[model samples]
Target: MKKSIYAAMLSGIVCPGSGQIWLGKKLLGWGFISVSVVCILVIMDQIISRAQVIAEQILAGNIGNDLTSIYAAVSNVALDASNSTMPALTWIFIVNWGLSVASAFWFGAQQDKQLQLQADSKTEA
Candidate 1:
């Protein structure tokens, strides 16, 4: 059980939400995947929109000698998007992955304990 939990943690580290799948929880696995997808899409949209705006400005000749400043501002916006969303998603992944691993261990330990109790009762009989 410990081994399985550790394996699930490793899987999650490699790919977000894979730990739930490893633990045989398809619904949770899919939920995690969907949330990740939505986050990525939102971040991508922000980045693309900002970039397009910068490009349009450059094409319209508004980016005169201050092109460097314009570039810097656009870069800042991109980084801000990452700063806002990436950390949140990363933390979410870490927490969920850890919970999945712990749950696997707990489930196995409970089953083993129950079996041990049953065996002990039979011996007493």
Candidate 2:
């Protein structure tokens, strides 16, 4: 029982659906992993685009002597999305994480119940 809970916690915290996969649900775990990968890619794209823009600004003019200040300037407006994607992406990430945690606890509980039932059956026999 404790082992299952801990397994769920470790995997869920690491990759949300990973706990489910560890518990024997490959498809569910892979789905969660894929969505997470997509989210990471999207976030990385945003960061890279912002970095490119900052690099362009640096090259176009004498905007700074300190690179740190330039980084700060770039970071401030890095979240300016072309559309309403930032909020959606944020929600997707949150929902995925929440789902993962919930699934972990649920699977752990199911495992505990199964073990209890098996032990009871053995005692009766």
Candidate 3:
């Protein structure tokens, strides 16, 4: 397979920035990795905190232990407007993944072109 295609696939399938790392773009790859990690951490923290709150309510008898009650609590948490960070983090993670894929493909294609040029020059000489 072409390096560009492979790199793009790796980035998309594995983790964002993995393709860039495969393409020897350590700085760019690490940058994407860091952003992705931060987004993931923040989103997870928000979700876990909400879950803990619901669990506490259930234990305290504020919320019933029934499935319906649990579902409603989850729904309320999902629709909560005060926690807008989750949506923003999700979008940022998605955008970062896309950018990493594109960057890996572009850099790989450039490398391929350079190699082709070198091969052509050698053949001429």
Instruction: Tell me the lDDT of model 2 at 120.
Output: 100
Overall lDDT per candidate, in order of appearance: 0.64, 0.76, 0.92
Q: lDDT tens string, model 1, 56-124?
A: 877787764386878676776667754566567666656755665565555445555777889999999
In model 3, state the lDDT of residue 23. Answer: 89
Q: Per-residue lDDT for 20-102 in model 2, tens only? A: 78778779878888888898789778768877777777787745748787967776666556657767887898788778777
Which of the predicted structures, 2 or 3, would earn the higher TM-score when compared with the native? 3
Clashing pairs in 2: none
Once fitted onto the true fold, the runs of candidate 3 whose alpha carbons sit more than 4 angstroms away are none
Candidate 3 lDDT by residue in tens digits, 10-54? 889998899989989989999999999999998988889999999
Candidate with top lDDT is: 3
Alpha-carbon lDDT of model 2: 0.76
Better of 1 and 2 by lDDT: 2
TM-score of each: 0.57, 0.84, 0.95
Summed backbone clashes in each candidate are 0, 0, 0
> Which order, best to worst by TM-score?
3, 2, 1
